[model samples]
Target: MATYRPRVLIGNWKEDACLEEERLRDFMHKRERGELLIQKIDKLQDNLLKKIKLSVTKDGFVHFGDTVMLLNPDNKSSVENNPGECSRLTLAVNLDDISIHSAISLQAPCGVSATKSVEPMARNTFCILSVDGGAVDEPIRFGQNFCLGTTGGFSDQMLYLASDHKSFIRSAKKSYLQQVFLTDKLSYLTCWRATFLDPQLRLEYEGFPVPANSKIIITHCHTNRGLAVPGNFWVRSYFGKEYEVVCHTYLDSHRAEEDKNYWVIVTANPSNENGTMLDRPSPYPGETTKNEFHEET
Candidate 1:
């Protein structure tokens, strides 16, 4: 008897999205033409299909013990020497899957597999869905929604943050969506709940000095369950050679009364010589100030 493979279905839907509205990196701009967009969409579909295969294959041997076909069978053993390899592969697959899913999510309300877990695609079974090239939708355009897939794997947010070239503003945008924006793949129960709200939690920022007469801001969102729960977050910014730390909190008086409402705090940092840090604000409140600092007075 032949082994079973899982069928992966991904979709795309434009939700009143305009490619031009959102700031596009120069590279994306060159590819913004109608044909290029179609080409990119098709390329994305092809990549996603490849990912589906790799995801299903990484499992090593596909076995149908009773029902479902498992992906990453023996993943632990094969990955022991390569602790992060499996996760990276899974992340790549998920990102491609999520990107494709975002493109077609609102098209016709099509149903994906019942669950996110790897499912069996019976032996000799195959299914493929593709988006044909054409004019962008009127109410909807390309690249409306962005996704990073489930939290089970490595986060694109982390990857972007760790990149040597990405600026704080760039990383912040991606982080906001990944951490705050509500999505089906994201869990409010597990994700939204503030995990590290500590006055002691240290924060740091580094890059370049801010220009004169500018400000920095920080923002934080929390649930109003009350009872402490890490209500404070800290931030640090780099000015020339030294880093300054600022600590703050987001209070919920109603949560104090009923112990039920969370508040998000956005804080700003001080201006520097160049105003690089000024452009990007802190996530918490009261963290910003107007003061110049030098190594030696």
Candidate 2:
């Protein structure tokens, strides 16, 4: 048998070994941080996913967990007595399993799931819930009651009065509620009245003539909270430049009362001309722009 010579170790084998060991350690440290961050985010998301439901009403009261809070006619100074409890009731929306935090900032990857692809979709539905009050707007307050009218996505666009069973009846006299209003292109104006007729709730939008083929959509409405009316109006100037105006109206029950109907107007004009200069058809004979107040039960 031939004798075998022992192999010699390469130069700087010790240095190479140390360098390799350092690289491995660095990778492990980074991995540990990443795991920890993921764990934190998971806990936070799980806690916020608990179900919270609200029953729509004309008085603007909503259920916060099991507690009922009023939106209108508020008298409470704080939503909750305990600061921690108040902090826990903050509202937030999560759409398509993506964290709001991640959606708002793309740099941070902590809350995103590895299996989920980051791509935009045509339509997305969001889940709304209460979370830590760190980022959301402070709960709206009226009197001593917490106003869920503008909170919890209960604005006019999502809620509306029932059209059947005479939920709303016209006032005795014709006034702003029956008048036709004019607005400039790129500008929006709206007004509304909210009334509760015992078991029924009524919401009336000030009437205006819309152009042919224009669309009318109710943006939000609530018997107990607020109302939102959004519609599109198309216009063509004397020079033939086409323009569009968007109008939105809201009536908050928590703020609206008998003889004090809620109203809001938005105006935007591409021509930069004063509102009076915009050409609009004259109001019908005997119609008045002034609002007529009436007492409601």
Candidate 3:
């Protein structure tokens, strides 16, 4: 089924977004648009946003089943005048693109039915209700895993984060939300671990409920590779230009490539038991909850 990212229409590029924005490399040098998105985030202090309670966890961390948006940090949104255009880059997995070279044949001794080679059209993620393109938010998290589906098998037809040498691109390992699956798919590749932001304290904080709206590193459990953006790399696809996301090692010193690995987390639009938006009571002495403000950031 077809899907649309809120305000980021899949194909067309507008003057406001296209002209005003720089190609990935150019923007890195200027850093002009990124700063704008940051200012917009600061303006999120509006009374309405401050009043709502978005996270369900008492501690405000995301829970196992929570639907959320995994966004690129320090990138800009496509919308004109959108605050993130200057402050952040709105990047996420593009289900429609990013394919693997060859699917791991499940019929082999180590393989399972789900990993077998299939016709290209057979495995596309159509009508998947989770994270349907933008941060309005909704991608269900499984036990440390997020599921993406294909018509051929099931939602379990995963976007695994394992290391594979058979990639169509030069990138060594991948978080396969791309168009095709590759050979060498192993059970361990499907595991992704969310760790605390600080590297020094990771083991102690691993698996704590991931905080909503916080920066995170989605380390592929099997290879210890961090999911990363490819230095504003761009490629042409059935859609317009698409940015590349890959599973990359942080180099032997373990500090290189850290710059491209940060991702921001935002939860889905949440509702209460009766299916209405949840209203959070303000804990501050003089504050009161009010209607929600729905501007995109």
Candidate 4:
């Protein structure tokens, strides 16, 4: 680990290569949403994913590393080549473990093809990071997704999207991946969710003028809670009339009882700048229990 601490994430890193036609179908059904991120990397053909085997141990150990060769799923004498052998691969990582960074490459003559395939491409990944922690203004909801605080919170965060929606549409659509990190001392201080809205229509209603700021409330409803699962995780939400719901669930073997949580009617909005959030009333009494988020401010 570096002197500067990195974010720790809870996600799965698995191998989806060299699959039997029938078995591959099973795997597809397993991590449909997670496969969306993998598909983005599949198009890039990076060495990071080449020749890797991922597994979970009985003692609850999740490991991700590389292997040189894999037995052909259908045969013995035949060997399968990892796509990394001859491609410039770009990884679309969804996990945020500070200790987890990978590099995969073949030695000697095999690396030539991989080296040549490293064509530079314009790209950016959206990430959530803590921005301002010092004294600023009272914590206020900016648009719908972020909260501003003088103490610690997401301020001046950056949002990066593909240059064009046409290209993005062709790639992974409707894929939701969440990465969470916490410091040893500061275990759980903050929480956040991302929402989308029409960037052009500033104000859609008569008297309710949309704030010039980045976030606006598309609807008011309940907070969404998701189900907890190991390995690959996928949660669902509904952007119904007057509200957008995002159910967040954390996975822990010991915390099996903390499953299927809800954030019923979370606020939502649109983003002309990058992405957006919706707003809800403060002190949602009875609706929630702990209100750690309310206390953070």
Q: Give the 10-residue window scoring lowest on summed lDDT in candidate 4.
A: 66-75
lDDT of 3: 0.38
The most accurate candidate by lDDT is 3
Residues 1-297 of candidate 3: C-alpha lDDT, one tens digit per residue: 325433565655363356446566575653555343333333321211122222344445555443334555543222233333333343322322112112221111111111111111222211222222323233233225532222223223433223433346533222343222222343544555565555555666544555665566766655666766544444543224555556664432544334456665543334453121112333554652221111221
Question: Tens digit of lDDT per residue, candidate 4, span 8-87?
Answer: 22222122222335586877874675444455334323423232221112221111110011000111111123322321
Q: Candidate 2's residue-wise lDDT over 29-145, tens digit each?
A: 856774444554553444333332322222222122212211111112222332222211111122222333242221111110011111111111111122223123222111112
Model 1, 1-297: lDDT tens digits are 213222222222232133323535544765775235456456444433332211121122111111111111122222454354321110111222334345522121111111112212221011111122222211111111111122112123211100112244422221221122213332221111112222222132222221221211122222222211111111121101111111122243322111111111111122332222224554555662322111122
lDDT of 2 at 255: 33
Highest TM-score model number: 3
The 10-residue segment with the lowest total lDDT in model 2 = 111-120
Q: What's the lDDT for residue 43 in model 2?
A: 39
Residue 120 in model 1: lDDT = 20
Give the TM-scores of the predictions, in the order they appear. 0.17, 0.21, 0.43, 0.17
Cα displacement (angstroms), candidate 4, residue 117, comes to: 39
Question: Which candidate, 2 or 4, would have the higher lDDT against the true structure?
Answer: 2
